[model samples]
Target: KTEKTYELQLLNSEIIIDGKLNDLGWVDVEELSDFMSINYGLKQIPSKKTKVKIACDNKNIYVGVKLFDDSKKITFKSGSYDDFIDTFDLNSDYFIIEIDSDHDHQTSYAFAVNSSNVKSDYLVYDDDLIDDNWNAEWISEVFVDSSGWSIEYEIPIDIFRYSKGGSLTWGLNLIRYIKRHNEYMAWVVLPEEKVGIVSQYGHLKNVNFQQKKTFNIKPYFAYDNEEYEDQYYPYLLDENNGDISGLDFSGGQDTYSLSQSNNKIGFDINYHPNSFSVLDLTYKPDFGQINQDASEVNNTAYETYYEEKRSFFIENSLFFTNSSHNNILFL
Candidate 1:
């Protein structure tokens, strides 16, 4: 089958991202439908219907999606912000937007949002190699009605690094998941035997590109203060009265107060050195706010694996690793 293509148009007016597709700018835009199911390498009609539309402006690209289903049967869980309901549960409906900013078809960005309005984003390298720790800031609103549910996204143009040109064509793909039927549908049906998912994406044509200076800096500050008290023996202390030379503290003990404090300030700089590449710099890197990994107890003779969450190291890890499949060095 030939690859599908869609011509993106400019929005006539502003669109408020209220999760409703009632904007006048989207009136003349065409909708992409007739999604096909790719379950077990079989192409068939899904139980529900799905449609997507794309439009753009000078500063942002707008996406509107409608997922038709029974309002009551929609599965979702409510939790804290960025809880990512889709990844944690097996029975949840969600939408995924994959965009190849550079149109290289080798790497892409995957943005996902569930019915609960929670969002999660990640980077895809070599089609299927996913770096789930990657995060981006974007706006999305979700609305649920009796007929079905819909979502709207406003992605900033500055988030991606694309080639310089008057007009550009990017790769785009949309995916929808239905939990009730355990069905998966895609606008561009990816065959199971396909070598790469991103390579099979449809084209998003006529993207007006204007090269502007892209530079961003994020500053983070962290403070930690710890206070505690400990008991020690006077006889065990040396000349410093605080040093113990591997002595057993089983004799009379005296209490002493101890306290420690630390402060860290760091900045993450992102600058587009050219139209096709981005330069990232970190000064005194600080990633204390990132989530901690779950504690695991190992019984067998196997090495423990830990995911890299540092922004500086994982920003452009593909280039650092020379596109290695193992991804053991930089990911």
Candidate 2:
């Protein structure tokens, strides 16, 4: 089967990162308006109109989408931090952009942003397993008008590892989820048998990118105070002595103490030698933001596995993943 393809034009002028697509540079870029429903067949047109435009610069790829919905009601949940996968439906309207930078089909990156500008990103492997803990440094904004809503995205080239400095072909797909109508539309129609749509993504051609090795250093200091009462017994007198036979047992009084404080200083360094290799070094790692694993009842003989949500450990974890074993191993 032939796949849909689009040629990304290089931006001549600076386009504002705002959600409004009023810039002059976007006028020349071709708009891809032929979208199909992901739920229904490709022949049926969706109720709402959707158009997507793509452009690129030396440092980032810019994507602009205009979604025209006639419905007055729109669904959206407002939050900043990551939410549980089960709670995604409670959020408002959103869109997803799945990209396979390496065109390997074995792995792809999925970036999504809701109407509230909340981000949901993941790393998909083998069109099956999804690592929701994967996070990338990207910017996206949303604007709502009387007609419909629009979204603009700026994805840094540093977030991806691909062959640079020439005409490159990458797998690309866009999905728009209309929460009010419970509609799912995509640029490339996905079959029901397919689990992850990244494996069947269409092609994005003529993408020429200039790669630069970048380094980042993040330093942080934290001070914490803990307050708790500690009880102690300094001494214990012998109660089995014959001299105290007429009396009862004897014991020393308890002593109590107050709180304590601790302070720490650390730094994390991220260095990219090339597109394929990344080195992450940390002096003192902090996992305060990571949520505790949810409680689950275990009735099976095997152990239940929980996903890793820490940002430092999840980034670039695909490189260390073993597909045969379906596990991420540290070497």
Candidate 3:
């Protein structure tokens, strides 16, 4: 296939982001279609049809998608927030969009959604290496009907890093997976040797990225009051021999009620001086509030491993991508 490019235009008005394509701002926009399968080196037309449209404003990028299939037979699945499903799995329908905001082929941000409207976002490095632990705040809506399914996304521009000024162009790629047929289709289909990567992607032109200072602050206060019963130790002398008794021979046991209180206050700050740099600060950040890890029973002698959930360490952990498969690394 040849190189493809889509000219994105500025939105005329605010989009409702309701997963419907009936909005007037979506009218007359270019529709990207004609997806080709890159499965097993065979380039053929997929059984289903898929169409995508994109628009942007000063603060957010808007995307609308329409995929045609039998709604009754569609398989839907959901995962934890910010967690992605297996693309090759036969139990779920998947859609993904990757964008190289800085036009750096080595890095890109991927946003994905399934038929159940479960959204996930991550960072891709060196074309194939992915950091799934990365997280971002974005919005998506999904609607399924008898004909097929449609999706809408509102991705904040501040969530990504990009070039500073002038007319901008970004690398773009789209992927669709059909669960029933186990088919994979892509807008920019590549050769068999170079499949499923971002080294060679299409272009998004006419992008006017707005760069401004953005700050997000979250403050929390926790008050913990713990009350418990405590047992009191008594000094009992032997009745016959004035010696210390080894055990408490007293018939009555003394008990007392104790209470403890703790007050904690903290705040987290995420400051974006511009689209290219970020500063994260925490005043007594609370790591205990993160979701607990899933329970697993290990029957063998080996230790059970757990995934990291702290944002302080998982944010830019992709820099050491060459070290190991794990995202967070300690030097």
Candidate 4:
């Protein structure tokens, strides 16, 4: 028989949310029953009246959660590692978090973010664990949510142990209580399934550090025009063909290209904490172009590829040119 290993830990800073994150004010992790609310779209069902909380000390990490379900229905599913490209399907609600820069091949940004704010994690499943290699000792305090529902969990710090040892910026995300009608949105943005691997969901920007560091700041801008031959301009993509064709045949006219141009500005600040460490990008614009792939590249590297043709990183991307929307994902 053969053996396998894993890593998922590193050094990093705290996450503080002072203002209202979304329109709703911050909900305390203690009295969760008062927070859960009923949402209409899905099934006119209310949120679970549960509490989700996690506390961590230097030596260990702890997570505490409370779950409230009136239906008393709970089910979980896990998948094997070798099931993508060769075997890919979005048959479940999965959210992932991967951390690199601390350990080695045993662990990586395979399922989440590193200590840096680079969005290069591809995960599967929300709320549930990804593999059997790791185990989470979870306990739930349930309740009936005529108003709504909720749950709580406790995760130990030993849950992760990576290769490279240094301060890191870990990514966080959650996905749960999703069905045909009702879907719980991701803490991180989840793009459409048809977009497949081409999306940006669950982005944890600017996770700080407390180790050797190199901070650099840069700001710039540019402008361009568009031309369309087809009066009915459409996005570029081939749901029919599995090949990637450029902007030529997607339904635009190079002749009708917008001869007009505009001007704008942007900035970037990155820190290289250690050799092989990544750059931080929490403050970077959601539409800023990225730095290009170096003439030399590393095998276990992570990066973000946006749809907008940024002046910075416009090449080496697997983007969907047809869909007319800003659909990004976590992976």
Candidate 5:
């Protein structure tokens, strides 16, 4: 590593922009595609043009994406991928972001929203055979800035762990509306047949600064409404298909799934221990809808991008991180 001093902390939501907000200086679909096409020599097909703006403070990264001409009248599809989706279920536009903290390309993070307003967070582990079972709270806000319509997201550094003020590269990919048009564009483009998460992304350089550490512990005290069912049914062996079983979710009193958003009753703690060495403790576990797999050590390419904050350890009420790493004598 070279010897240098760079401002590493995004301490507050205060972003230092070099100049004024120039919507004209924006990257459109074609311009972005052409840049990617020429550089990667990939015959990039075109997609719908969605205007986006980005800025960051010490505490949060401010992203303003303009989803133009969204046909609010149409009833878009609300579920997973299917053939011949009904006319009422085609959303005109949505958004996705592939974030790679450093240049290591083993796997990266993928988050998106569909035109029907459905939200999902998936892992681009093997970009080609992309599976969709990752759960992350795609929590964000949008308001009319003086410039244009903007989406403001407060993404926590603890959500994706890295040292304070540390810097790394990222990848960007955005899918569009108008499914008949079938458009998807990238910041750094790739091939036409390059379909899933792995093949599409281009690089975004230098973005991270752990200005502060905030573990938002909001344990809601509320009453359960749904009919709680605790039934351990027989597992099906047939290969036909399955549904989002209400049985799996229902509980004894009002069962909770160790989820932050849906289950808001328990004293769910978000621990922010002083030492970053507690890194071994923090884990972002798989969701309840589907507990896929959780044995991988290296998440993304960047040595600075892996932060596992799984809720299982918290809800179970036993913390192995401090107990194991510190060799604490707990009687």
Candidate 6:
């Protein structure tokens, strides 16, 4: 298989994570342009133009993409949160980037973002199986203008599991989905059968990265109030006809009380033990922001299974999954 390679330039200055790509670091790096459509016949020229630039520094890898669409028919879904993992692919114009940090071909990380700046990520293994629940702490932004849209990504080195090195070669592929036209394009031409074939990904060379040991602590506090009501049947007696001789159970008494307000305090600690491993610790974790499962009705005898939505359990969940089988074994 032929592989295309690009030598990443070392960033000389800091790069702001804004969607605009006007930084000196990005201007100095070489860009990979003229994306090809997946269909071989359409490879001559793509309807939309895409240009990608890559740069790396000691702590992070930077990716800038400029997509030009003459029609400017952009589709974006509005939401309260920035990260919309479940519906970003179906409802908006987006891009997906597959990265094999170790270049093992057995496993890869997929990151996606839409024109609305909503993000979705996952870990792919065994060729096609995807763990959409996976979440990573990365910076991404999108900006749309009259001509088209542009996106910038700043991926931290700690988010990936790779051997500590100075210069390394990795596997990478870029894919764009135009929702309005239902068009798919890629940086590397791929057959329809090999659409998501990570093994066929091109090569990214001369990635000079320095893994830095870092620690982060996030503390949170929450309060809630709850009210409770109690109801019980009351014993009844007739005074005129000798009380206690007959019992009437026709009425019930109700009692209401307000319990003490609930107060919670917790923190999450992240420690980078090495370049290839990370340790996370949490207390009283809150998963309120996690997306709820889709409503389903099952009348069959077998029970239905739902994906894990909690951020604490979804991040780096492959370690807890049994790769030989499809079950996730949490010990």
Clashes of each: 0, 3, 0, 69, 22, 0
Residue 59 of model 2: what lDDT? 88
* TM-scores of all predicted structures: 0.83, 0.81, 0.87, 0.29, 0.48, 0.78
Give the Cα-based TM-score of candidate 1 against the true structure: 0.83
Q: List the residue pairs that clash in candidate 3.
A: none
lDDT for position 198 in model 2: 71
Q: Candidate 4 local accuracy as lDDT?
A: 0.33
Query: Looking at model 4, which ten-residue stretch has the lowest summed lDDT?
Result: 112-121
Show model 2 residue runs off by greater than 4 Å: 40-43, 84-87, 193-196, 225-261, 289-307, 319-331
Q: lDDT of each prediction vs. the true structure?
A: 0.81, 0.78, 0.82, 0.33, 0.42, 0.76
Q: How much is the lDDT of residue 17 in candidate 5?
A: 29
Model 2 CA lDDT for position 107: 75
lDDT of 3 by residue, 204-233 (tens): 998888679988887878789999997766
lDDT of 4 by residue, 1-331 (tens): 1111111222243423221111121233222122212244222333444343433435433223334343333322233332322222233322233333232212222331111111122312222223222223222222223432333222333324332444344434333343332445333333333332212322222323333445666676767665445344434567788455545455444433345566666666655664345444433353535444325454655654423334223111222222332485533
Considering TM-score, which of the candidate structures 5 and 6 is the better prediction for this target?
Answer: 6
The regions of model 1 sitting more than 4 angstroms off are: 79-89, 226-260, 291-306, 320-331
TM-score for candidate 6, please give it.
0.78
- Candidate 6 clashing pairs, residues 3+ apart or interchain: none
The sequence of per-residue lDDT tens digits that candidate 6 reaches over residues 170-230 is 8888989887766778877666556456677788898666767878887877788887767
Which candidate ranks first by lDDT, i.e. highest?
Answer: 3
Worst 10 residues of 1 by lDDT: 80-89
Q: State the lDDT at 64 in candidate 3.
A: 93
**Top candidate by TM-score:** 3
* lDDT order of candidates, top first: 3, 1, 2, 6, 5, 4
**Candidate 5 weakest lDDT stretch, 10 residues:** 1-10
Q: Write the per-residue lDDT of candidate 5 for residues 1-331, one digit (tens) a residue.
A: 1111112222233432212223332332112223211223443544333555554555455444554443433224555422122322245344565664433453555556554444555555544433233344535543333332333344444444333444665555544444544444445544544555554455554575544544555343433344444535433343455643333323334433442334433433455553132322222233332334435577786764332334534321223432333665444
Ten-residue region with minimum lDDT total, candidate 6: 78-87
